[model samples]
Target: MIERILEQSKALIHVLSADRRTRHLVLTWQDTEVLESIHKTLHPLQEFTDALSGEEYVSISYLKPVLHLLKTKTLAEDPVDTDLTKSIKSRVIGYLQDKYNDPITQELLDIASFLDPRFKTNYIGKENIPAVKARMKAKMEEGTRKEKRSRVRDTEFNSLT
Candidate 1:
């Protein structure tokens, strides 16, 4: 039954990609389902990687399990086949975009691209995020300074009067 599903999936994926005029797009329903399952199974790994890396809110360790899981599933032609790193990366980016409201960073995007074509052109660049962070930090500091100054002024006024 599983084998049947995998075969159909490969055919369907090939058909769909071909239909879309994508000559090499390949992923059948079984492969798609398996990839989804792999994604689901790797949630814990991502959490672990995020916690370990101090980038808990923005980590991609969840991908490892998916890749590993793909090893077990059979491909259309091969007994088992896994997507290239680029495909994995794009999926990760897509996952993050769908799951989180945060803007995708260039560093992460680059890492994804480096990892797989799935990440190709997914983000703009790293040069912009830092300026935004810096500006936000500066605004916060400025607000704090103003609050402290107001409190000091109040204290001075009370002491003098």
Candidate 2:
């Protein structure tokens, strides 16, 4: 699936590059620079996605680091043209923020990160650590309660039988 997506993107890039009229109009140095920047940013994500595709269970914990990487890479790209780079960066940042800035989604990502032994609170901010830990505790307690309820139901059914 990842390979297919990448191939389709490449085909689109090829078509855009090949166009006679719009090609000359759109393929400025700044445009090329922006495309390169986007490509560089996406390559690692493609690799990560491929890696995750092989897994039986891909945890939401992966999202936090992937979001971090996207932000970091987009910011790190050198501005070939200040105005164009700023515009591109602003658009990308706005899209990410709009999609991922919900409190519930952030809390879920933070809890996943906190629960993963490999990450544990390492990637989480100091300010969010306490909140994430609290959320984790609540989730564990909820699971315990559910399990107890299930066992009680099973025991009651067995007794009735």
Candidate 3:
């Protein structure tokens, strides 16, 4: 009888441990789903980076398409979604908006994108193109002015010598 009781207790412990493991897995399954979605959405972007040269790959313009893709993927409803997943998605959107939504940065990205012959403002919206072009023109003028000033300084120094 003692041996039978010991065997029953061992079985009970095994069952309880299994139940605890199942509960842990159930609780954490949502995290796994979120991570899997992130991996799936970003894997292609990673592969794209591998195909680009250093300069093109690191440009701020690359963030536009990547952010678009990530927003599209992460904002969609998922079967196993949880609040944590939603929070992560919101944080990503917020971060991108905070870092790149300003006019100056947007203008810079537009200029960089426009300078790339492969794109050349083709991807920029019609409404924004005029403003971006204006900003680009202003920047070019500023550069030229600085260059002229530097040249004048150089001539003055040469004359003094």
Among these predicted structures, which one has the highest lDDT?
A: 2
lDDT of each: 0.50, 0.70, 0.64
Ranking by lDDT: 2, 3, 1
What TM-score would each prediction reach against the true structure?
0.31, 0.61, 0.52
Which lDDT tens digits does candidate 3 get at residues 1-161?
33343335546555666885554433244544555556544454455556444654555556555555556664544667566655655676677689888988777777777777767776676798998789789989999999999999999999999
Which whole-number lDDT from 0 to 100 does residue 144 have in model 2? Answer: 100
TM-score of 3: 0.52
lDDT of 1 by residue, 1-161 (tens): 44454547767665667665765567655656676555544544465455546653433533433333333332112323245433554465556446543455434444443345443333424565455455557878999999999999999999999
Which predicted model would earn the best TM-score? 2
What is the clash count of model 2?
0
Query: Could you tell me which 10 consecutive residues in candidate 2 have the lowest summed lDDT?
Result: 1-10
> Which residue pairs show collisions in model 2?
none
- Please identify model 2 stretches exceeding 4 Å from their true place: 1-56, 77-83
lDDT for model 2, please: 0.70
Colliding pairs, model 1:
9-28, 9-29, 46-62, 85-116, 86-116, 86-117, 86-118, 87-118, 90-118, 90-119
Ranking by TM-score: 2, 3, 1
Q: Judge candidate 1 at residue 90 and give its lDDT.
A: 49
Q: Mark the 10 consecutive residues where model 1 has the least summed lDDT.
A: 72-81
